[model samples]
Target: MSRLDDIIELIQTTNEVYFITAPGRVRTAYILVDDIIELSLKVFLQEKVYEQRVNCQIDLESASLVTSRNHKDSLRRYFEEKLNIDELSNELGRGTTGVPILQNHLVSFPLIRHWSANDPNARHTFDRVIDDVKPFFALPTTAPVGTPPNPATNLLDEALIRHKTRNKFYHDQNLSGLDINDEKCLSALCAMFDLVDHLFPTFSDEVKSKHTVRCQIGVLRLKQTASLGHRELSQPYEAALQLLKKGHKYDFERRSVEHSLVHTVSDRFFGSLREQFKNTIAKLQVRINKIDTMARPKQDHIDEKNDKEKLIQILQKQLDQINALLGAP
Candidate 1:
């Protein structure tokens, strides 16, 4: 299964477990949810960085630097050094030790800043949530020494509370002064879903489309055979063509299909077709030679020879078609 599949399954299973487990285990559920969220964000950011690198949007030196770090660290470095956005990078300097620091910083990072720069609503959404999210990354000491932690100031604060609660349960093996209940679990889930919705709004559709393309490619490969005759070969060829057509319908970017067709399938298919044509030509030449050797070739023999010539012509036409498809010289 793909990494995206694993992450989606993790989220779904954790949600189910949270609903069924006893209240005592709800903290564990929350921790599991947090871990899944962290994993998902890391995967998403790493893929984004990879896409940028492949597109030549990231310089070689910066790409080399980011690749050296772990995924989370790579994300932090990319945002800072590559994108020149210090939002996620600044979180690294915070004194917090055990918490997943990258995930903490993600709440306030201007993830949509570049993509939504022209849209005021997107900018406004980030501005409204920024202050609420900032406190989650603040050092514990920054809170009052004796005063009870203030009630969650916003959804971001609520997520932070769930994170801290889970951290306490992990380290202390106890949930002292913490409440683990359906409401808390639901709240954490909502905050996580919200973050996911904002950060990867198109994630589900992208996954579905990719899976469809992958399956179509698999079917094309399976339909192909070593001994495919000219007619038989068309099935797989047309299947591949259909796959490319469907992919173009969904994703207008043709680079991937073009690359696969030209670099992968075309080369192998051209070689196979050329070899088949050569073999057919050689066999036809042999039959024509035998027909010539017949001192008094019968009418039936003549007709058979004519049929062989027609077959040779048909094979030549098929070779031409193959060459056209491959854009071969």
Candidate 2:
């Protein structure tokens, strides 16, 4: 199963399963999510660092890629092979903001907590960092963001609040903060999912709506293949989808509260995570296809055959890694 499916199975949302009761499922989800964000950033940066460390010409500015240290011999004692961005990520100076760090171990000599003292906008807060990456998502560009940006007007403000709450839960056994009961936990969990939606790329509302038409077209093809095509059977969904693309979404309501729940976990339920994973798989597949195309040329010599074999091995390794993540055979 995917990591998301594992989370769904492990986090019990129900109040009771037998004579006993289970609580704090959403609270656990909160903790896992907090760490996952940090881990994802580290992995993402590691790849970028590996790809650029030789020339030290990464597109993004990061202290971890301090190319100035290339000639420093003493430091080479510790980093004899190559600079490992992943190792530098654990340096005490870096916090969990998940934004690229401005002062790494070599750059600072001695760590400084207030690295953003020079510029306030560059402050390392979850609130601020999410804003930078949100554009990479399908979210409305105008969605408000700040360092603990106004909750009254900003949806992201609560993400910071949840982090504070998580800190309280994590650091204190006495549990002094607001208790993470069902209502509070569910609300916090939904907000965390909103944070996740901002972190990853997938079809936005309009994109997803356009996708709906494509999906219907796929179904229509299937029907045509089976000699069961009918125009009326397909018209209704496609028409609604076209209107949806214009921001005219329609959904039948079972109850009033259900309207508010439409965008919440109750409605979308891990959809963002699944979509992000699907996007990752699509990207890996694209890379694999390109590598295969490179290997498909005529092998006119022993050297060409050796190069082709190496490429195939590299492709197989990537596929194996992806399959392991997917729990595939």
- Residue 70's lDDT in candidate 2: 38
Q: lDDT scores for all predictions? A: 0.49, 0.37
Q: What TM-score does each of the candidates earn?
A: 0.33, 0.29
Total clashes in model 1, counting residue pairs 3 or more apart in sequence or in different chains: 0
Task: Point out where model 1 deviates above 4 Å.
Answer: 23-25, 57-158, 172-179, 204-329
Candidate 2 stretches with Cα past 4 Å from truth are: 1-26, 44-157, 173-178, 202-329
Candidate number with greatest TM-score: 1
- For every candidate structure, what is the RMSD over all alpha carbons to the true structure, in angstroms? 23.5, 21.5
Number of clashing residue pairs in every model? 0, 0
Tens-digit lDDT string for candidate 2 (214-253): 2222222222322332332233223323333343243442
Worst 10 residues of 2 by lDDT: 12-21
